[model samples]
Target: MKTAVEKAADTDYRELSVSPHLITEAKSALMHFERLCGRYQQMYNTQVQANKLFVVKAKNARMYISHFVQVLYMSIQRTEIKEEHLSLYGLEECNMIVPDISTNEQLLEWGRKIIEGENIRISRGAVPIYNPSIAKVKVMYTLFKEGYQTQKLHQKATTRVQDEVAAYREKVDKLILDIWEEVEKDNMDLATDQRLDRNRQYGVIYYYRKGERV
Candidate 1:
């Protein structure tokens, strides 16, 4: 005696009823949410750790630079030596006072110029010297500069990525909350009458009576 429309509606309502499958699906959603949240947390933690590491590296780099500069300052401070003293001096070997100098690339370029007999104005009135070893020092200096700049850029990029990832995680969390609210609203009858837990994460649980399609 039931009309086709009434039968269809009844079927739909039955399908909407709470079920174990819905609970499983909701639990899965919560797990997914937990995973996403954990991912963000891990990324944030990694960035923090990286920053700490950079601080240590930066300090070490500074120390090396200071040591190299000290050596150069000492060499220049030798007032006893005049132009003649250096004129007789051959190219001194360039040593890495610091494993990496911030301006090493620039120094390297300068080194190449030195090799090519590039004009190196020592004192305001001093003539350019074409020393093989001095060219090497310039090259090393250039390398240091390049290395420092590159590392600094990388650090900034890493920080930016971390921030973006964190923001994304927050947005996803909000979406999950909204989804849960919507599911709760649409299935209030089942949630309230069935005494089902509506606060679960993910979509609402749709249950079917025994021998039901859902």
Candidate 2:
């Protein structure tokens, strides 16, 4: 449970015999690693926001299309078409007798395509630096490992810092990967809903249980 700052202090030269040059190098490397962590966090936030917006817009578009087709189906059910109603509803092209079942099926097909397109877009829109950041963290971690291996003085202090750096890198890499995994899972769920009636509607519902928290 050692904090990252505490681990950094461990390598900041506790031994009187440790050279100032080595201490300076270690401090500088740690600072750079922290800065990279900040950048990675910012990148992650941006990507999450982008993903949310993309999904929301897609849902809105699908809703609009579904509603439009529903309206068209309802209009076609009329026994006689009126001139005023025709102009008001703009039902010129939709004047023909279109079955409700066929209309719903077309809407479902459109929804599937929308989801498929979104999956492709999400796959292509992944942050370019995501993987490279993990690689950079691994490289930065090697500095501490090498220092720990060669240190003549404060061996225990160096070891603590080296292990901490490794842990930090692993944590960061896992976080980035987890975010990517969530996005992929979301897209997969959308694509898989093609067979379900939920896709034709507004997707799966989260019904309220009696005691469940909102």
| Candidate lDDT values, in order | 0.45, 0.40
Q: What is the RMSD of candidate 1?
A: 13.4
Model 2, which residues run further than 4 Å from truth?
1-22, 75-214
Q: What tens digits encode model 1's per-residue C-alpha lDDT throughout 1-214? A: 0121222234443443333344344445545555665665666666567556555544544444345344443554564224233222222333323223344353344334333322333444443432223444454444554555656666576666656657665655554455445456655666454534532323334567999762
Poorest 10 consecutive residues by lDDT, candidate 2 = 195-204
Error of 2 at 141 (Å): 45
lDDT by residue for model 2 over 1-214, one digit each (tens)? 1122233355434421224443344445557568665655555555556555444444444445445434434534653223333323233444543223223335344444423432343366632122223233333333333332333234444455555667677655544344334334434454444423322221222356899873
**Residue 203, candidate 1: C-alpha displacement in angstroms:** 8.1
What is the lDDT, from 0 to 100, of the residue 163 in candidate 2? 59
